[model samples]
Target: MKRGIFIVLEGPDRSGKSTQAALLKTWFEALGREVIVTREPGGTYLSEKIRKILLDPKSRIEPMTELFLYETSRIKHTLEKILPALKAGKVIISDRFTLSTTAYQGYGRGLPIKTVETLNRIATLGLKPHLTLVMDIPDKVFARRERAGEKLQGADRIEREPDSFRRRVNRAYKTLARRPGITRVNAGRPVAEIQREIRARVAKILKRQAWKRGNKKQ
Candidate 1:
């Protein structure tokens, strides 16, 4: 069986990556494709536990320590969920992946980009997403959305950071998207418009893949 495409949606918090991921999964499924929707730091049981530790506001972990924990979660998620699904020819729509680590830790936390990239490679085991759709929104829009949500009993350490940190994270995401195989989507638009843009992109990718397979068969 052909290996399935791995697509990731990445952005700062409240950028609607999760919503778009779900919508893309449904759209792909409607086209008779098997699609799996999953998220980083919480895709597997082990990862979910790590996610709790990482996200807890009370936790006072060091920067490197936090990065390692995220890598650990990603390694487990890749092995237990992503690899098997791809081998079975199912498209995997990941809400966040290695990019988050790079942005959050490498940029937001001021970690060296080279070190973060090395760790990310190990975490992913050389697997790269076939496509990455980055949702880009202004920092002001992100802040508005974040504040609109109910205040949690306690905010995570990352969430508690000043707006400057989040802005750096967003900049990192945009930089990453400039690399090959990543598509930057303007997420500042209306929800319906964003969804339509994503659908069109996915359709084009599917068509190209189908054409490639047909040629190989012929």
Candidate 2:
């Protein structure tokens, strides 16, 4: 069977990655594709446990400690959930992936980018997403959304971080956008507009993959 498409939607908190993931899943299902929507650090039972520790505001985790936790969760998520889904030919729409770790732990926490990349390779076993949509939003928009109480009540540890940290993360995402297999989406528009743009890009990728497969069969 053909390996499934792996798409990751990554961005800062409240950037609508989850919303886009859901929309993408629905769109894929409508096309009669088997779709699985999962998130990093919480895809499997062990990963979910690690997610709680990583996201608890009361917990005090050192930078390197936090990094290892994320990678540990990732390996489990990759081995238990992602690889199997791909082998079975099911589309996977993940809310966040390795990019998040690079942005959050590497840039936001002031870790070495090269070290983070190496760890990411080890954790994911060198599996890369087919497409990664970096949902880009301006700092002002992000602050406004936070001030507007978008998710103030249930803010995760990362969300409760200082503005400086969030700014670093935002910049990291912008820098990461230049990498291969990444498409930066301007997420400051209306929800429907953003989804439309996402769908268009995804359609192109699907078409390209289909062409490649047809040629291989020929």
Candidate 3:
């Protein structure tokens, strides 16, 4: 049986990633595909504990230390939750993945990108998302969302940072989207419209992959 596709949705905090991920999960399930919806930094029990430390507002963590903690959680999550589901031929949709680490810590926190890449490789065991959906939005919108109380209670550490810091993170996301195999979505659009666009894009990719698999079998 063909292994399942790994789809990751990445963006700055409050960019509607969770909503889009849920929409995609439902869309895939509606098509009769087995889908496993999970989130990084907290997918598994051990990872969830790590997540608390990583996101806690009061935690005084250095940039490098924060990076390793995030990677640690990812390693646990990948081994315990993501890999097994993918091996069983179930589509895995993640709210955030390695790209978040590259953007948030590498660019936002000014950590070395090379180090971040190495850690990500080890954490994910070289697994990569078949498609990465990057939700792009302006800093103004993100700040407004945070002020409006849409931010996650504990995960607002990044959001509460200075505006310039958030801009750097957003820029990193845009840059990553320009890389091969990453799709950029205008997250400033209405949530419904964004979901529709994501669903269409995902459907197209799945169909193409299915055709490729069929041809290989022939």
Candidate 2 structure quality by residue, lDDT tens digits, 52-91: 9999999999999999999999999999999999999999
Please list all clashing residue pairs in model 3, or write none if there are none: none
Shift of residue 141 alpha carbon in model 2, Å: 1.2
| lDDT string, candidate 1, 1-218, tens digits | 65588899998898998778878888888878898889887899999999999988889999999999999999999999999998898999998998899999999999998999899999999899878889998878876775233475667777888978878998888888787888999999998899999988877877898899999999
* Maximum-lDDT candidate: 2
The lDDT of each candidate is 0.87, 0.90, 0.87
Clashes of each: 0, 0, 0
Candidate 3: Cα lDDT at 164: 88
TM-score of 3: 0.92
What TM-score would every model get versus the actual structure? Answer: 0.93, 0.94, 0.92
How high is the lDDT of residue 200 in model 2?
Answer: 94
